[model samples]
Target: MTQQPLEPGQAPAEHPDAVPLYGPRYRENPAEIFSELRRTHGPVVPVLLEGDVFAWLVIGYRELHELMGDPQLFARDSRIWNQWPNIPPDWPLMTFVAYQPSILFGEGPDHQRRVDAMSGALSEVDQFELRARCEEVADALIDGFAGSGEAELMTQYVYSIPVMTVAWMMGISTTEIDGVARDAVAALDGGEGAPAAYGRLAATMQNLLAAKRAEPGPDVTSRMLAHPVALTDEELVPDLLLVALGGQEPTALWIGNTLHLMLTDDRFSLTLSGGRQSVGQALNEVLWENAPVQAGLGRWATRDTQLGGRHIQAGDALLLGLAGANADPYVRPTSGPPANNAHLSFAHGSHGCPHPAPEIAEVIARTAVEVLLDRIPDVILAVPAEELTWRPSFQLRGLLSLPVKFSPVPATRS
Candidate 1:
């Protein structure tokens, strides 16, 4: 394969207010950047993703709401994107924008079938059983570092909870759980190894689908295999990939963000660090202020239309500005209390993370946080909060590490 040009004639230079959506400034302080963008460029601002990929970033609360809710105007399919012609074969965002048979890019009847299959399969996940599994995984993870007195919770605990539970839900045995988690992280992290990692995960899902076909069970894979609408192995595999990979990173970050908040903010610290008190509020607050998945790959315009006082041409891609919308004063002026989880953290409309998925994620996130705090009540930030660093990605907002210190504890097992 040959490399091609990188810039969209990169309009940031041409469109002065067109904010380049990458760089240390954006990564280090996205809120400040969003605030500045709202003040200077208003809600629907012209932006450049890395490689000078031009797209719309819909930051206004109502505007984002309308964009997501009204998919008729803004379609979910990326194949309609006008910018595809200019995108290089090796483009960094190819995985995000690439059209797939998966639910992520599906539209109309196809989208509905996939969503129904996914939602129905997810609905079969018995919450109580899932909780027990989570507690078991959480306990085992905590036991690993319990005697250390000091540990990096992100890698050891926060990250492990979701993947393992999701693995259990998918009927993956404990032996193969680590590889599933490892591959999911690498594939989504969008590095040089991402393509190969993605291939490995896809292959794993195919094998699972085959097994479920011959002998189904009480698992997400088997349930999807048994969905009424019926999906071919080709159709089912991508959605399975979605469930497997999707459940991990964001939920892990959600737990990490909530913990970071509980530790740093005195308002919730005393209660949150102690036990279950204020845990729910802390989680909700983090959803509004520090959404794990800050931005979604987004929607393409079906036809030319007006949005946020700007003309949007047909096929123009619009990145769903979830974090920005959550912060929008017009929609959620006061953030401390969730106005019924009105935040677009899970996105909305046809293409949003379907029912039971967000609930499931919240369960995993909340359980992870509560169990960790219960096990290590004395945990505190190993370094000053300001000294903590974040991974450099405009799409996901998460701490690179969550190093903490606590008193050494006797292993509950052995």
Candidate 2:
């Protein structure tokens, strides 16, 4: 199916603020739409994406939560692909198999079964081992650019960490992983972005699957092969790629955003190093205020239902505002700090992303922080926060470049 241009030019429309907030093509600051509708249309508002399909935009946290709780009513299955006429057959499959369920995108008994398999994989020993490996990778990557004083964090350090970690987890060798990782990132280029990246990822996974089948190793991909309900290479590659894309790109954005946010805000900076409790809270706030993913886990309405006073018909594709819902004042009473509100950065309910690769991820994130502290402790932004280039993406929002400056650390410390 050919994708309709939702917002062709993507500029603001003629109606002005009084009418529906419209953008020329794709949604710009969708959060703004949700915020505006919160006052005017209740929590849910009837919205059109690319100006074609009629979907509900869920702005409020409570309403979003309720919708996610019932998988049957708000399904996240094959129906979502039906709504996107743009996804061509050549599109790269997701990095991991999402359809068969893996903790991020599954339903019913199959969903539970996948969750159980993943839970076993997340044992304490496995986590500790991954952490050790991630720390080494983090140190090597960050150290290489530490002397430069200012580096493109996302491209240089952010994307590298997760890609390397996920690649290693899949049993891909370090020598070949860089090329595969680079191609994997490309697969996520949908629409105006690079479309063939997905295909490359699928191909690479296919090769890896064949290799593993002949001689399975101790990696996650190998364990997946041992599953009672094993998926074929063709079936698993796309979902695996999706997992890789979701795990890598969004994570890279989150890490970069966190650093940038903390650098600008004193409250966040103060609490960052105060152990897991403080760092955890700061991470929560960053995830809420500046998540890599802008839209919520998508769902296609199974039946006509009234949500937030809006008539949602069956087959309508709904875009829930994970960030907006997290910040919604009507949902939770945020008292002590900004981080206290329950956030949907990882999505929520049935399709929520399991903290897969949590230990490795945390080690990498913390090591990035440590590297900055050790190399350039007093680093400050060279430009205003607003001046930073936010990559124009509705699905993923992140800083394209963040310039900062500081005197280098002493020779001994460096």
- The alpha-carbon lDDT assigned to residue 14 of candidate 1 equals 38
TM-score of each: 0.95, 0.81
Best by TM-score: 1
Model 2: per-residue Cα lDDT over 189-251, one tens digit each: 334335455556667778887898899898767776676666556545654665566657777
**Each prediction's whole-model lDDT (CA):** 0.84, 0.62
**Best-performing candidate as measured by lDDT:** 1
- Per residue, candidate 1 scores C-alpha lDDT tens digits across 1-414 of 112223565563435566787766756778887888899889998998777787899999899989988878898788888777688777766777888888988778888988999999899888888888888899999999999999998898888899889988998767777888888877777666777778898988998888778888899999988889989999988899899888988898899999889888888777754658778888888888899988877899988899998878788889988999888888665545454688889988888889999999988988888888888888888999999898877788888898999899888799
Off by over 4 Å in 1: 1-9, 12-16, 334-339
